[model samples]
Target chain A: MPPEPDNIPDAGQAEEIAELVAKTPDTLPLKRPATPVFVPATLPDEPVEAPENGAALENPPVERPISVPQAESVPSQAVSVVAPVAPEPVSPPAVEFSPPPHQTFRASLTLELRCATPDASIRYALGAADVGEDGTLYDPAAKILLTQSTGIAARAWVNGESGPLALAHFEISQPQWEKKEPLDQSDATPHEISDQRALEGPWKLAAASVRGKLHAHRGGWREDAFAHDLAPAADGTYAIVVVSDGAGSAPLSRVGSNLLCRETLAHLRDALTQSAPLSTDAQELRERDLPLLRVVLVEAARHALQKLNEEAAKRARPLSDFASTLLILVRREWNGQQLCAALQAGDGAIALWNDDNTLTLLGMADHGENSGETRFITTVGMEAELPSRVRFSIRPNLHAVAAMTDGVADDYFPEATRLNQLFGAVLPLVENGDAPGAALLRWIQYEKKGSSDDRALTLCWRDDAAPQPETVTEETSDGHA
Target chain B: MTSQLISWKVRDLMTFPFLSQLGITFALSAAAMSDIPPPETAATEVAAPENSSSDGGAPELDASMRRLPVYLVLDCSGSMTGEPIEAVRQGMKTLLSELKSDPQALETVWMSVITFDSGANQVMPLTELLMVKEPSFEARGTTALGAALRLLLDQINQEVRKTTSTQKGDWKPLIFLMTDGEPTDQWEDAADAVKAARVGNFIACAAGSQANEATLKRMTDVVVRLNDLQPDALKQFFKWVSASVATTSMNIAKSDAPVGLPALPPEIVIVP
Candidate 1:
């Protein structure tokens, strides 16, 4: 076949010439004549052809020779045959496409024209070569569809001078998906997190969890969990909302997060039953309920920690293998006041979008010294700090309360301020939807660079106009709880 | 914010029809594999949708837009002349191309090229994969591996942002060092400093038969040796490096251990 790009030197000819030059000295009378003594060695063209396909290769490990297993009977002869000049490299590609052409997608390609020049306008023509500033003014929203193999050349037009012409060729082929399997089959978690919604009185509960794009790409587990139940409170029904983020490095963190959410709510329900009911009056409850609410929250958190340890012990896995972060809240509505008690460990946030129209981070977000570092529920002394971690609040005109794993929490990072942005976006999903759980799942997957982690969010709010409620909601109650 | 969220959702739901006419066609890339994929059709979600941005630039380029800084510290010594140097160039071309195609890497990966010859210099600054001007390479003088390490250290410290109360930091940096021979300069203390600082997730590559493995071990726990010095090995090596970048960028709030990278291609072997 003809070389498509004439500029590329023919590698086959180069290698042959290199072999001839290196062998000239070996053929002389002074050199050791050992290579012809061992008859079965094929030297000229085998190593060149051995790695015919990438699939045929697997790493034999470091500090070791290539496991090609050259004939050992006459090892020195093997070296002397082609020993002088080692295997040379194949020639470089004719033209180095700036970012090499990597993929051939089955479906059409979605192309985004980018100009790093801060305020440059990008213009492009689909079928042309180098469409400087003459194609069409680029719109960020109007998607550019490439349904066939096309050359897209775009340039940033700024200050009457064009930036380096950005050119790329996209190839379209039949649908192909690269699949990555979980390393351990027995430790596999669910592929998709199901939507769960519940309603009581004017109060509504919507909980959702979705595997992040990266995790989905890698066949990684949806390590986040969201669960809510209208467990019996002291005087009224309390909406117990919980969300946990499992450690990505942990082998069984998906199981751990799910277990922690269920146990914590269960333990909290039983613990709260024997407590004194504080006055439903908003002013009185704030003064009286603080001490009692803190204790019950810690007790529930401690029990959940113990459950993780027990589950870890049962599976014969390290405690760290079942590590996860926890965010749990128990809130009740009585008279006109809405009182909430939140317990958090690790980095996720428990925030209340209060009636006063301000976002309040109910508990502290604990990130250790590093960027990706955070304390897990299974961390030593986690329970010791549980009491101080609880935050109790009484909001008379409460709008909504949300509990989210760091997957969702970190997207709206520096959660102190950006949560209002998250809350503003989520309010529409809750108020104007029949399946808020499903909406929440889809809504949390908003495109953000470098923010790919399994997102789990639970939102509960009171809708005074939704003409009360019957007890006819699908109760996600397991008989054990 | 709501509009941004809705646009992404809308794109996810959109489907396309294949065009009958191929426009502006070119010959298959030299790196392109010849084998056709088996027609195994499964409703698998696109593994890399997260990499592409339907929107032009990341909004405000704020905290959530955490950068995955990738440093390529390469040895362009006299020994790396001719075929070896060209292979490095070819490998980088393929690596950068593959990274840009990946949406996540395109969106978040910022790469810097550092080369060492008689002395080390930052050939390219930390720039976004989408906007980076990949520099042309040449093989000139002795291997100054120590100067390369020290320069890499300084660049990382100066470039990588740290997470504070007000601003989010860049993800832990990934450093890939490719060398074809032993260092001619004093490199021991520099290598020790790289290990001691606990700066980046380092993966050193011994590029050819002349490449020294013991010298690389002092700089990093993860070291891989390039086999044969063939173009195929070089291609596979760059492919694995790109995937390693993707793997590190994918990991959010992970453990203390080195991030789990994809398995090495046959042309490379990990030093245990």
Candidate 2:
């Protein structure tokens, strides 16, 4: 058969070849033993017997004994039996075969032949053999020829002492080379997060938020909000970043979320300016300055609530209509160490990415028994709930810290392992060419399962040297509240 | 918003030929099953719903769409043996056929059927609408309304998934109870249980003259009474049900608010 285009090996091609070879017959009827067989050069003086069906024998008429070498040098055990029949036409009909389930097939043919003379080299040529060395004509020593073509007859010429003998009657049926895909071992395990981002130094603050697809489809406004301020403290060392998320059910929650962000940063700034500088030691800060931080958070919450109530009264609505969650992160460099303090309410997460490629959850989202239900900053007794929700930490090797609303939490903090892997993937992007917040916003919006919620994220990091503030802020306002 | 709502209603009224073009067969299973606890002298028969015979046998499920589970708790007492029972069957078929044509309804609705006679039995388990079959009903024995409510509560416990801290579960279930007569068996205890379950929505429907509207009112805030058992009236009620389901699916897909049920058909009187 003519050679067709060689197929590129797939995952299952090796298995198919093994199976085919196992199914192939080891010996054909024409294959002789390795022992040498001599043919007398001289024939009897009687009239040479003509083969049946008007075919004449092509044997040499020399009258001497000839020693035929053993067939031990043949690469294959199959012997080529030259028949004196006319070559069949090489139409090379296209054959289509369906493979079994989970299996793929390629067209091929297996040729078996035997040559009789010592120098009886069998040269087989397949039609259209342009598919490289593997698809071209077989060498003279090749007794078994395999080609990737079907339904075309192969022409084989045996060169011997008697001269070239053409045997072109050999026809091959298309072989269905079956291959099965390799079994995947990772099917039963949870997906492993891939972290390919390259981290560098000199990071800046970036924040972005997008309205959810479902909300946009319903013509609803983007209720989620966030704000980050990196003003230098009086001591010229600390910076503050505040983030918030508004309740989707509340019509005025967006106002509340934005107000809380500004008010929280303002309150923190006032408290830091009024108070005197304390010890730079981590233990001293935890023991002495922690209570002061708590007071700052409570005071900020009170001011934010007062502002929300004034707005609600101005509009003749209830305060509950402006429910929102808050997250406050304070960072300062003390004694060559990076320290962070955070306070959070409701379903959003804060993660700290350290220089050693480890992620620590500074604050996990506050979730209720029911999914999508969580505590809000506007709860009746948020002041009392503040102590448990506030978090403080100090890390000399900190790279970056991020705070995100529940929309991003669905993808980054669905579980502990995913949280770590996600932070690892994003921390490097903090120093990437794309603005960190824009990169994160793209990552968050990349069609994830159960992520159709308003997303707001704030990323904060300190550069090795003071550089121009690389601040990126993105917001989407559909104009309907 | 008004135009969108009107468009959806108009689409609901217009029937499409795609219903017949769909290759899925609506083969009802005669066997009854219950995921609920059995009452004394259980007469319920449990078997798999016809569509669940093989995973490959039914149409593919769209995993992206959240399921809006609907339970139809029907009363098959002796009072509804003739015309009433026929109307119920026709109404159910009409509901299925209309919902099959609405792409949103097909994507989000999951339905199950429970019938109470001497005792309650789940004739069909909670199944996706794409594979749902029109349930068969036969009026017989007494109206064991209490037992049916108990079965429904139990089924809700087993079938409906509640949200947890880490994973999101199935949406809250919507239940509709249609009965033609007052309960012959004790039902007050079961009514309290249903109320305590805090199901997303419970619409009690009293069909025909013999049904007790007062008793149904106690079971749910939304109560509609069908004064007469007629095919056309029942068809309107079923159309209303289909519209309500479609609206709820659309609402939940967009917002987290409680499902807003559409107004009842004019033929059915709403009990204040």
Candidate 3:
């Protein structure tokens, strides 16, 4: 005899399956491919009541008479009556699903389950590895709605026997994204200025500034700026590399960073040529070049800050709106020694890598107690702090020197401890056969787990001309007043 | 001395049956009621809601990525019984739709809901965005905000992962708290504890005229005030919340700016 059908949902295929199974009372359900029966559009059907144990329901299991397509079986002239019998104490009942086991993850998905055995209690778990005692009882009246990717495991128990686990896995494919170009409402900065350049000089230079993944995700352009040029004076060739990272919160910081790097390099070149230097005695370098170089680097940084102020004034914006961190490095082989003068305001680092895998931090990264608290060059009175942040080093046999924004510094942060590993990562870029500039650009684009800020990296090292002749003569003996 | 004289006069007039029913005695009683300030401490400390049948925390999610834990602490007191409660239901629907459409939020954001009314309870635990079900809330009882704050502190400590030398932890949790009236429980201690924990970024909303903005100030520096209890204002609040959560989810893994929230609608004003 067929099981009692009073509690089965009156809507959808479940009701039709019950009557069809009643016709063949001796056979099991789900094994037979019972054709689906569709309800007429005109029936203002009475809704079934919810199960007594309401708290167990994760979803409202009540079935509403909704319209849908697909009529496979002959439209029944009227509802078929089913002869009822006491629920047979059968072993675990076999369960089947309407939609196949695999499904796609969306905002939400509705799933319907069918059981052929009589009086079987179906319980299910979602997103769980397996169903156990913690699974929710599946009330037949409700449909299972899945909102995210998950594994659904269901089982049915009849009398004392438990059925085998019925499992389904739904996966969400990568979403198709629409191409979006940033709107250039402001004339201050272009939407995209990501670029790379290779410079040939005493110092092999490779420089790149690229937008980060987070910015690209939201249609934002790169906010880092870098300018590297081999400044030539009468005495020697000086490789000046400047890198600036714009504040993410500042809308026009791209302009700020770009202007700072350009103006600082320009001013430093002019100041280096005019400052009666490079001709001073090498033994008295600290007394002569140190004091004069400090003024030159600080003045260049001040000039950059001044340009930002002028730009902010022209735009009728606050100076703070153009906040960025600036790092400047000037390297020259003067009198048989690699002489370097560097100044940093705000966060980021200027480091020199030695041949033995040791890295020396030329200028320190200014950081507060929290990771987010970073200094910017536009901070008021920042020029006053420049003299102290400036570092002068006259070392022998420098392997490589790198100037970077916080974007690169953050990957190896707690600056005190991570510089050695940073050079380890940076050391291999030049040997990649192509222009080291292009290689550096590709290197910065490499993905790190938590590093998604706009990156600006400028690496300068001695190429095949490492032992090149030091062509400097003591001439033009005028000294700065 | 003046209040004492008035009390004595009220007592003396109460002896006369005809005058006892007049405004003098009623006014005296009203004055006495007003004189007793709202209690700062509960006689018995309110306990965090235990994991009841429905008050279970987030179910196990099949995720290997770092989660962005977000908590919504709402006030469901007796005053929010009618239109206000219904508006909140609609707001949740709006918030869910907003978050689900946001690809970043849908990918990483995990959410939980805590409701305070006479006592605070976690209606839903930290569940993934896909598995998050909009909690059904009922309006009744006084605002036991202290219980809610303490419960939130406990829940965050229990659920949020911390980064160590070996593994990266979950991003700092984001909390959005909304209340429409003065708290009816001792909340100062809990507020102080929350302020000192530095465990999460908080956005406290003093959501109606009766809401104590001063009380919320102690809980967080980022406080927004709603001038009225209108449904439109509350709906805008929820929309702003959706935008903030979406923005945070995109930046949570990479950027290092202090939890930058999106701009609020005109209906809400920043509490300076």
Q: Compute the interface RMSD for each candidate structure.
A: 22.3, 26.8, 25.4
lDDT of 1 by residue, B192-250 (tens): 99999988789999988888899999999889999767656777888899889977776
* Best-to-worst DockQ order: 1, 3, 2
Measured by TM-score, the strongest candidate is 1
Clashing pairs in 3: A61-A141, A61-A142, B57-B125, B58-B125
Residue B145 of candidate 2: its Cα lDDT? 93
Question: Which 10 residues in a row give candidate 1 chain A its minimum summed lDDT?
Answer: A72-81
Tens-digit lDDT string for candidate 3 (A1-481): 2333343445654555454334333332222122211111123223223345533333333232122111211111112122243223343444445344333544543455555543556665664434554456665444554543455556665543456555555454434223344576453444333333443344567777777766766777677888877666677767788999888777788889899999999998787756564644643554455667778888999998999999999999998777898999988876566777788888788877655444456775666433445678887677677776666655555778889887777655434344445555554656445567666666777654335568887887766544444454647768854
Candidate with more favorable, higher lDDT: 1 or 2 = 1
Model 2 agreement with the true structure over A1-481: per-residue lDDT tens digits: 2343333335465465344333333312223223212111122123222244322134333221132111111112211112334333321111111111122111111233333332222232333211221222333222232212221112222221122222222222322112222143321211111111211224467666777654544445566776655545554445677777777667677678777887877877777656657566545554566667666766776777687788889989887777888888777765555656777777778877666544556663666433445668887787577665655555556777788777666554343334445554554555554555566666555554234567776776655554533333537577866
For candidate 3, give the DockQ.
0.03
How many residue pairs clash in each candidate at the backbone level? 7, 5, 4
Q: Write the per-residue lDDT of candidate 1 for residues A1-481, one digit (tens) a residue.
A: 2223332335663464355344433432332233221111122221111233342123222221222112211111100112233322321111112222245733233444443333445565554444544455665443254434555545544444444444455565532223356676765666556465555568787777778777766767778886777766556677788788888888788898989988988887777766677774544544456556777777888888888888888988888887888888888865545667787888788887755445567766776444677788788887787776666554455788889888777776666556666666777767787888777777776766667677887888777568864443557878866
Write the residue-wise lDDT of candidate 3 on B181-265 in tens digits.
Answer: 9999999999999999986889999988899889999988889998777778888998999999988877553333577789888
Query: Which residue runs does candidate 2 get wrong by more than 4 Å?
Result: A1-201, A273-275, A354-359, A364-366, A411-413, A424-431, A449-451, A461-481, B1-68, B76-111, B128-142, B239-260
TM-score of each: 0.67, 0.57, 0.64
Residue range with the least summed lDDT across 10 consecutive positions in model 2 chain A = A91-100
- The segments of candidate 3 whose C-alpha lies over 4 angstroms from its true place after superposition are A1-153, A158-179, A185-202, A277-283, A419-422, A464-481, B1-71, B75-97, B100-142, B150-174, B180-182, B192-201, B206-237, B248-272
